[model samples]
Target: MWRQSHKPTKLFHRAQRCRPRALALLALFLVASTLLLCGIKGKPSSQYDPPKLKRSRTRTSTQFRPTVEYTNGTDLIWQIPESPKAVLFIAHGCNGRAANFWDRSPGCPYCVGFPEERLIVLHALDRRFAVLSISSSRKCWSLGKEKHVVKWITTWWIERNKLEKLPIMALGASSGGYFVSALAAEMRYKSIVLMIAEGVFDTMGIPEGYPPTLFVHMPKDQRRMRLIERNMEALRRKGVRVKEVRCLEFPLSPNFLSDRILGLNQTMAVKLIRMFSEKGFLDENGYMRKDGRATRWKQALRERGFPLEKYELLNHIQEELNLAYGYHEMTSLQTDDIFDWFESYMN
Candidate 1:
């Protein structure tokens, strides 16, 4: 019987001898399998999360933004030097892009940039007042349904960013002019400058206790001109601090408007702009700068004291515009007048 027991089988002996190691190997396999099934990485989630860049609520897309955003949860922003104290909202007319107003567009005559795009003069003069522009999501501002656009903008900036008390200025051209007028009426902005504005002319400027307003329009453009005059009269009846400049014939050069009708150049609209502040341009004797020194000064008009608006080597923006045949547009000094008035009044 003892002899029959024989030694335990080789496999049985080996298993008994390697029991601890076998157990360890089995445990390791089980753990790995469990982790794989559960979709676990080698490290803790908190320890291995790739860093995410913080973004402002104002940024609508997860994609990187092109400009610096000062406040979170707002669409408004400042460019270039960035984070400025005061801001000017530049609005454009129907179909006008944000840059359609005041940019240099050399090689393109229709661009707003003066000297045909040599510089960004509008913003260059005053670093204190930064410019903010809006694109036309739609060609026109919602005259009725969304007229509260400016109010919403102002409220958002004020409530969340502590800009409620900061002075705001608005400048709009044509339809944009109408849009900003709505804002000027609703908000206690510092000032407003409207060129070829469509709504609230001098008409409502007084009733809303709107800050000082500077309006620029062309007398040649009769319908709008009359609306402006009517607005002014309405304001007078309501009592408003308002000013206006109307151009009957823009100053055109001998070639541009060579054989002048009414003995005037349609080219000199800028001079007409300067003349709006009539008292501001004269001396005690009430004499403005003269055009008598001109090579072609009409003897008769020189005697009448007609002053030139300084269009010497005038900006040929239309040439620059040819480059941006479809990409851009040109605005004239006729429109830039709004910027002048806004800057002056706000300061």
Candidate 2:
């Protein structure tokens, strides 16, 4: 009697173990049948789906289309949104091209670079602001020579697009900031944003009715910081509204690279982070010990046979590093606040 009972219990346990396998086979069969039916109905299987990528969310709509036009020995890159609420003029820094603010679009083939600045342009467009940028005639902005040309282009663009009723705004960085300040003194803007730059008070002094100006600076150096503070005080004393956004250093994490750039996987991101730590580039808490630009991380990667053929990826990585360091460079980090200044002063 004991032997028979023990045999029956063993058989029952075996049956129980088989149940999960049976269910798994049934699920597999159902999936295959469904896929077969989809094929018979002229639908492709899941193989055709494209892989999702990590990248900037700049809109690729018709209104966000980029256009480049060369006039009077200068290149002007612009985008016009349908029924724009305002027109924003962007000025690039020294040795920077107007293409810095744009990404690759269907209409513009040479519009590939500077993901950081491009984010600022994308934010402006999202706020229904048409963006326009003119490449400096020289390596740096020649305010006296380019002033009339810029004014003419602004007028022609406004008249041609029938956008005279919309408010005009300007954003400039470094040398471009100085140029825009002088331009704003003459042409008048609803508001203006100066990035990594100070107002030209002594030479091209801020007039009494200067536009409400917002300064977005990194304050990485003491001299520049003092200059910006003085400029802000000057604007305030003149009854001009002034606001300042100070950019600061940000700590690094494992996903810092993959989170910002496209075509990088989490595994690769982890490996890179480990490599950076091993190279003594990052401290115990993941903050950069040295300037990112000074770190030869890319050279190390190249030595390890990492692919660097894609120029877009290279540019994106460099910009991300610069942003993380919070150094002197164009940034999209304070984009929201920049536009808020524009909106607050808008009519």
Best by lDDT: 2
Per-candidate RMSD, Å:
33.7, 17.3
TM-score of each: 0.47, 0.78
Task: Quantify how close model 2 is to the true structure by its C-alpha RMSD in Å.
Answer: 17.3
Backbone clash pairs for candidate 2 read none
lDDT of 2 by residue, 1-347 (tens): 00112343543465456657634543443343222211110133343221112223333333447888998778898888777999999999998888877766667777764766777887788888999988999999987869889988988878987889999999999899988888999886999988888868768776778898888887575688789889888888999988777665555543546655545554455556667778887776556676778989888877756666643466666677676666777876567668878998889
Return the TM-score for candidate 1, rounded to 2 decimals. Answer: 0.47
**Candidate 2 C-alpha error for residue 54, in Å:** 14
Predictions in order: lDDT: 0.43, 0.72
Model 2 off-target regions past 4 Å?
1-63, 262-267, 307-311
Poorest 10 consecutive residues by lDDT, candidate 1: 51-60
Q: Give the backbone clash total of model 2.
A: 0
lDDT of 2: 0.72
